[model samples]
Target: RGLKFVIRKVTGRCELQRICHNNKPGARRTLKIGRPTYCLRIILCQSALSAHPDRVEKTIDDIMTLKKVNPDTNPQLGISLQASLFQIVGYRSLVAEVEKLRREPYDCENPDHEEMLMKLWKTLRPDSPLTGRISKQWCEIGFQGNDPKTDFRGMGLLGLHNLLYFAEHDKATALQVLHDSLQPKHSKMSKAEWEQKNFDKAIGYSFAIVGINITDLAYSLLVSGALKTHLYNVAPEMPSLSHFQQTFCYLMQEFHRFWIEEDPCDIMEFNRVRSKFHRRVLRQLKNPDMALCPHFAASDLHLVNL
Candidate 1:
């Protein structure tokens, strides 16, 4: 005799929770039952499954095969097993995409990259003319040294891409942040005195260099899967490089504001302030429904409490 399965709505969608088996001879069965039938008590997210019907069906098929092959296996493991399979696939895909960008070393010899670099500089300083090689103006844009190439060594092309994206897409905001980086607010001092103090301090804070470092931080979050919670929610369809770039933008702006507010006494304090900021971001990412929208307020960057 076959078994009769009962589907009931729990929470929001139909779930298969119980199976009634009939052992009587010549009994009409509602559903075909294999030998050693087991009751499944899986509670999958009905809405999520509906959104991805094909994928959910495939996952269910795989689970069904396991039940057939291992009749003695616990049916309670079905829900978690299916969920883990999806998560593993998502993690691998996200990591692969992130790694592709991380491994792409910036090639100075590439004409396209060189042109894009020039474009970035020009966007920041419209009055400045493009140069053939690295110049002192590179320092004006926040490179650590005369040559900007050395700064890209740690972050590779991902750093440059983020810089160019910000400059090209949001020139006004980008220029404003760059200008702010050069001038730290002074308390209880005249404008002339502040300028003199800035000169005396010479803390060597470069806007462009710091932006690259933030890119590294953002990349670390993605690589470490700390970003998966937010990314999964924000990009339910398919996360891409653009989503990562958006995160870079958020970090760049947020860090700039945080730096000004902290007003570190010297550049040596950079590491300490940066660590604090990184921890805050990680805390926000811990939320399951967190999403980093482009228009987030500087003061309210924390995830919404759900």
Candidate 2:
């Protein structure tokens, strides 16, 4: 009875006491991505954020019960801990929220969503203003039909968002890649041959549609454990929205290069070449030093908190 009493009184280095002592949750650079651990499992099982900032605090409270340490001992512990944990585990939420965005369908009814889609057009085709929402001009950027919303089927709004992010963030590269995609395989061909081939069918690729497809590839890397090598190395602190976007940028550029290098007969060779490119990326990632972002510039967390 005496030993048990003492045990209850003395809290361990769990949430409550750790926070009270002002434990530095400084950079968690050593966190191993992909492989699940007992601690993370505990965190996931114990608490979840309920769609607000307060929920982050509430999550701390949930963990506090497990430690049995009095919050009153250090009045500031609760507030400080919430802020600290928010930074520490916020990347998990970032990934979850991003995945949620993937599941969210593109709503043409939502003005905000439409604005984003429009921004993609303006960014890519600045000189050519879209005459109407349903104009065939969308195909200039590489949508199959006059309507682009249909192109974002399985990927949803994330497809559009990623395409926009690539266009907006890496404008020069994105535009150059788009320009290259518009080029014909047989540049020296006569007008007669070009006319017979059909311009759309003769182009190297479709930039906007391919961006969405690459979004699917990036999402695959995020969900699967394959991206850990590049992600772990690049974002040593934590992954953020920009990190994912930067990955998308890298992929778009790399794919463009890869497509050109393969010297495909036509756009029909996309799948065969993309599969080969995927294999090449997988092989490169097997080396611990491989970084998708050629330069280590995607570390800025200011775009949005992770």
Candidate 3:
């Protein structure tokens, strides 16, 4: 009327046996479960556990849940639940870090942030001088008006951080993308004609504005966990903000090319093109082995025609 059970741990698996009182020999039945080797280490090495014991426990629980969800599916070919949990936790921590920046409104009063902004502009332009706090030069780079601060209202310091990171990391590529956004080439029009028409047609879209918008898009993708697919495949361990910034750079360049290729009639079609591009990104992320990085091929940017 009573049952006893024993659990045994092995290198790559765990075994559970249910012992029953029966007259027949070999009455014990064993269930072999595929357990990640790390789980056993965590259980045995109490001194080596993380400082946050509760988080470690939660991670173990998540691992159990993951095993339940994908009983037979091994997405990473021997990838353990503990490893995946670490990546997930790292991703969430990064999200929290970025969200903090997003929530923090840009304070013009803060001299450091203000200096960083000017430094970003200088890095992007190089030759052009920072005339003053507000100038037409700001518009040349794609701000809506003479002032750039107003545009960062939505994304806050997060937007500036992304923009500055891209510019500082790869100034040449960032400048090229900015120029391309400003004056996209068309198949029929000459360079002069295209430059003339670019202003009239692309009213609301500009390099700086579009870059900030793409930052928001990238942030949303991270928050929704769609980026986990790519992160898990590319980064075996925890991913950093640099990974996200790299992704933003790719989006900035790719969206510039996509916008030109689509040749929308006006800025009104911005939403339509943006939605289509979002779907494309989601589709790519849906692939189990999709790996995307900041450094992409010229073909990847759709620059073959150019």
Candidate 4:
């Protein structure tokens, strides 16, 4: 008789059921299922997330007919379904776009790629001059080697894109974080203690490397649909690169704080700390109302609140 009962009878926990249920007055109990929502996507081709209004309406109609939920009696439910469907399609579309960028290698030959890299350097290190593209000066900002291009191996352009977004938009926060990252993690360690225990001579974590790794983390969460709760709640419309980038900015800053709080003995403990952080975020996303970046509004991370 109810929308949830009818939907489940037709198809065991449809995407709408998995995504739409929340603790609101007269609303069905929340179903924290992820598999069914994605199973719905697998049934439809990639183009099913079409931006065209007619196609979307058709899809909604098809769902209504299949689930036997009358739009007249369940007007509020239908509206909720439409919003959930938008999140599904929006998240899928974002994955496609981000995957395209991830697959693309960082081509130094491409002037555009090179320019973006240089822009990142200049933005992060305003006073410090870049001696050359392949210079060791790149290390100052957390590049692993003389040639920073190699570090972009797995993340590719997406890594550069996220880093540059952080530098350009949140200049003050980004620069301050970079400066902090460069400081030797252990303040009280003497030269003899440093040798006694294999410790980093300077810089706790490579800022650029950690940013790229965090990008990968964000990408993983997005692809796995763990971010759906955040996206669905934060953005009423479609989620885009801007949403993803803002998430990156949030993660990068959060991780820096997390690192300090954890008081990691060495950089080798990175994986353990990162894994813990990932699990904590996953737990947070399990809540339907979770918003990772901005719990209130959709903005370009004024960052002060964060």
Tens digits of per-residue lDDT, candidate 1, 111-159, equal 9878878887888989978565767767768877667878888887778
Top TM-score hit: 4
For 1-306, candidate 2 gives per-residue lDDT tens digits of 465456545754443343335433332222221123355446634444443566666765755554464677755656655654444455565568679888999888999989999999999989988999998888888898988888988788888888888787767778888877876667676777655635564457888888988998888877775665566555544466777878888888889899888988877888999999888988877665556763224334222212
TM-score of 4: 0.79
Order by TM-score, highest first: 4, 2, 3, 1
Q: State residue 33's C-alpha deviation in candidate 2, in Å.
A: 8.5
Q: RMSD for all candidates, in order, please.
A: 11.0, 6.8, 10.6, 5.6
For candidate 4, write residues 1-306 as lDDT tens digits.
387567777765444544555433111222232234454344334324585555656676766676567778766656665555555666778999999999999999999999999999989988888877789788778888899899999899999999998888777888888877766666776767554532244546888999999999999998997877676656665678898998888888888889888988778889999999999889887776567773223354333211
lDDT of the candidates, in the order given? 0.62, 0.68, 0.64, 0.73
Instruction: Rank the candidate models, highest lDDT first.
Output: 4, 2, 3, 1
Worst 10-residue stretch by lDDT in candidate 3? 23-32
The list of candidate 3 runs beyond 4 A from truth reads 1-82, 184-204, 296-306
In model 1, pairs of residues that clash are: none
Clashing residue pairs in candidate 2, if any?
A: none
Please give, for residues 1-306, the per-residue lDDT of candidate 3 as tens digits. 011112222223222111111111110110011122455445424422442536645655554454343434533322343444455556667788889988888788899889878988888888989889878778767778887888899998989998998888877788877766666434565677665544543323677888889999999998997887666555545567777777788888778778878878778788899998999889877654565556543212221111
